[model samples]
Target: MLPVFTTPPPLGSGDEIAVVAPSRPIEESKLQRACDRLRETFSLDPVIFETATKDWEWLRDNPEARAEDIMRAFEDPAVRGVVAVTGGDDQLRVLKHLDPDRLTSSPTRFYGFSDNDNLRLFLWKHGIVSYGAVLHPTVTVDPELHPYTERYLRRAFFEESLGVVEPSPEWADEWFDFETGDPREWRENDGRTWRGEETVTGRVWGGCFSIVKWHLQTERYLPDPGDLDGAVLALETSEDVPLPREVRYTLRAMGERGLLGRFSGVVVGRPQTHSPGLEWNPGDDYREQLRDEICAALDEYNPDATAVFDVEFGHCSPIAPLPLGAKVTLDPTVRRIRFQ
Candidate 1:
């Protein structure tokens, strides 16, 4: 097993946080609102890069520029944390330009999800901790940040462990229209319930499924048995909402790479709401097929490890913040996930 490492302390009040756009560009207005909310609500001073608000013409206008912003954020001692504006599909193109030494030496709170999975695992491989959770635009635009999201963000970025993560009292649907600026209505759906009351604690790792699968093809964040040993594997799919066979193939590939059996447990997020082109109805059996594929993969690979499902951590509303590389304990009996 790769030796475990410690993360730096959370950003206290009055610390500076840098906001950057590492992948696709974003809408300037929404980005500014996100920054403004952070300052007004949390008293955090933010530093934003130029490209963060500008939508690059391509995957990224310049991968080197993205790398520079990240490096600068890490190198700046005043910057206590870093948050991505949003995530996009192609971040692997920028991996080669990053300076791992800077990321390793200055450990800041790195927050993002979806395609940011590419960067999160990169940080993890270098012994730095990053977070897999809501980013600025997604969480900031909420009429009010979801209580669970705010609660966990506070714990992950400021305070210590507040307590366990329970299923969101209310959840959201696939129809949230970002352009309208209205808070998305909460929609609860049925799925698997927490199985048992046993808390399985271990190091936390893993990220978005499609992105992780993409990373596997490159050296930037390929899974290593040594790095994954004893870590808790966490995953969620993206908006693409891949089919069951695709999901199975991806997990099966991980198993082939010897990554499936190395973790202490598995935490799977709820499947995303709007999958492109697949107009699956609310009560369709697509999710059931997904569950079956996942179970098959797990049983084929690591049947002994503890596993749980129906976690509200994906391209869903009212998401929970998860600190990557931190310690997480899953209690199926009580339906709680505690990060310590």
Candidate 2:
């Protein structure tokens, strides 16, 4: 059995939430709007750092500074949670500078996805609970944010148990054209449907597959021998929408490392359809290929593992906010996910 760790304390309406650029540099204007939305819509204070809006030499150019911001958030008695403005390509660079001892003791509610997977997995290893979910502008800042997205974030941060993880009726990969300063584009989004039935329950973990593969190669965010046993592993590809083979290869590596068998169940997020160079058909064929590849890998490691694919979460609209270390009860009987 995995040694369950501590769950971070919840946030209150008037409490402050820290915003930091742990991975990539977000546009100043975009960051401002996201902060504004958080305050106006959510009614929570959005605290930002000096470099929160700047793009310097690298996304994580100032590793020490980035680490400092995280430590500060965890140490601050007033700050209820910490959120990453956006995800960049290389966040593993910031891992070495982090004070794990400080994080292990603090257990602040942290949120981010994509490359932020580096930080999420790091927190998991140190016995601190973190969130693997959408960020500010990615899922929040828009003409109108997804109702369920806002609700999930609110409950994940402030409420005791994230009551029920429901299938988002609507989902999307559309980016709110923030260059216009107008929030009119927010309503554009794809919708979600309930996929295969039969929910399974376990602790939640995992994130962007690319980032997790990167961390595994670097041996940075590995869980202790028994830290992840019986956990419900959740994963999603980034905007890149990697080929089915690439996904299989990554999972194959996990099996080779003996990590794939640690999970009691698995939750696969619906892949994003749009990308810069590649275009994938949002059809049943593509979905079938994806399912075949992922299942092939899992079957090789743990054939009896409970798996659910195409869950409405990840780098998209109407995404689900998952607490990295939270216990998740996936009841397929009702197609529900309850976090306790």
Candidate 3:
């Protein structure tokens, strides 16, 4: 098993949460809107760090600047938590510049995902349970943020524990870019699907499969295989959706490394099966296809491990901010996921 990780205190009214862009730059307009909502809804303070507003080219060139902004947020006594404005491609570069001591010294709350998972995994390695990027998509959403997502954001931000995770009323099948344009195609939610029997309780590990695969290949960011024993494996696909073959290969590698059998359960987030310009959906054909590969992998490597799919997280519109390394009970029989 891995070392014990600290779960940061929840945010409260007047608490200051720092917004930083460690992976990519966020639009100033969107940041302003999110901050306004944070103040109005929760009566909390939202502070913007340097990288969140910096030009894209500059942030890309100086990975150290990104690291500095993250460490700055962590080290600040006034800051209660840190958030990634959005996600991008090259966050692996920023990881090298980070000093674990500076971050862990303060032990403040953190929330981010997608490419931001790189940093989340880093903090996880150092024994700090980091959160999902609730403020990322919640920042610039049009009309208003989805109620499903909003509810989880509230729980993650203000509550000590996110009690029971329920299925969203609706699911987003299509969407626009973060900068905003057009409405998201909302479809009726079908809820979660479970495979394997028995309730499994453990700390959740893993994030966007592509990023996890990257860590697997490098072998630098991942913990020792045996260290994940009895942990629940959290898996999901990003907007840049990978085909089933890719999923097969990655899981095969995990199985070969003796990593697949370590998990007592698996929580697979909803995949972005349909993205603008890369439309490849013929009524859940691709979704089922991707799911099949994942099941195949689990069957081969971890036949007894319980896994639930399409649980509204990761790239999906309605997301639950699963705290990496935090204890959770995944009860397949009751269809309830409770976080502590």
Candidate 4:
């Protein structure tokens, strides 16, 4: 049976949103722009936590400090929501310091992705609904927030529920150094593809593929397989750009854990085939090849599950934040997805 989660309160015009950094160090200038937009455009107040603007070394060495910021955010009734400044690789270290009861007591909407997925999942384990990372970064985009992003951000923040899940008109996979002031390029979105005939309705779970896999590996803060029954499993790769086979290995591990077979459907985001430092090239049909591997693993562990690929969500420009722990319907017959 799917677990029922307590939905956090919606944001009001003057509501306060806590800006925190649980993992990576951040640039104050970029963060200020995001905070400004939250105040001016979203009509919300943004309060930056002490840990958010700390230098890289300080953030790296101070897990307890990062955890303190998180505790303060949730404990403050004035702050209606909590969002990460950005994601990093070391958030696993910070999780140990969080007190589940104290965090869950307020049940404020928490948002993040990549490493921040760590906190989202932790909140999920306590039966509290939180959002995938989309709000903060979208506010800081160079030219402006894409309408697709704006539409979803509005729904996720102030509205009762994120309505329909749709593809962006255009998407970008590369990142530019914020100091350079160059805009990230956008290309026509190919949209999502369906691979099953059946329609399924289920609450959403899963986030960055690596974060989910790490939880399974460490058996840390993971929900019971029984709790995930009838869930729409949402998974995506980050800029780390794991090879196609590595994705399969993680999927296989989930299958072995008796976890993969419980989902009613799976949604995969577009994989970042190339990054600045990565050696991968797009000519190798990396996307298609990765699709095949995912299909193969699903066939082995979850043959009955519906699978959809290339639905933008994580590590991509113009993302639609998944309202984790909320119900969504995926109809492959017409190739449509709607969040309820």
- Per-candidate TM-score against the hidden true structure: 0.91, 0.89, 0.95, 0.95
lDDT measured at residue 92 in model 4 versus the true structure, 0 to 100: 85
lDDT score at residue 123, model 1, on the 0-100 scale: 80
In order, the Cα lDDT scores of the candidates are: 0.73, 0.74, 0.84, 0.83
Report the C-alpha lDDT of model 2 over 249-330, residue by residue, as the tens digit: 9889888878888887888887766666666654535556777888899779867677777776677566767677778876
User: How many backbone collisions does model 4 have?
Assistant: 1
| Number of the top-ranking candidate, with lDDT as the measure | 3
Name the better of 3 and 4 by lDDT. Answer: 3
lDDT of 3 by residue, 1-340 (tens): 5766898888888999998989887667777878888888768898988888788999989999999999999999999989888888889999999999998888888989999889989988888888886465755575676677778888888888788989888887566555556677788887788988889898888988878988998889888777698899998898777877788889988899899988999999988877666655435576787778989999999999988988877888778888898888988889888888
Q: Is candidate 1 or candidate 2 better by lDDT?
A: 2
lDDT of 4 by residue, 1-340 (tens): 4445888988988899998898886677788888888887789898888987798799889999999899999999899989888888888888899998888778898888889888888888888888876344656876676778778877878988887777788887777557776887878887787878889998788899889888887786888888888888988988778888898998898899888899999999887765777776655477798899999999999999998999878877777778778888989888898887
**1-340 per-residue lDDT for model 1 (tens digits):** 4545657668888789888888876677667777776787677888886657566774365888888888888889899988888888778877888988887777777878887777888787777777765355455656776677777677767865535777777766555456776877676656445433446787777778877777776654664667777778887777777777788888898888788888778888877655547665424665677777887887888776677776767576667766677788887666667877
**How accurate locally is residue 208 in candidate 1, as Cα lDDT from 0 to 100?**
87
Off by over 4 Å in 3: 176-183, 279-283
Q: In model 1, which residue pairs have backbone atoms overlapping below 3 Å?
A: 196-332, 196-333, 197-333, 198-333
How far in Å is the alpha carbon of 248 misplaced in model 1?
Answer: 1.4
**Model 1 CA deviation exceeding 4 Å by range:** 1-3, 134-136, 161-163, 189-199, 275-283
- How far off is residue 331 in model 3, in Å? 0.8
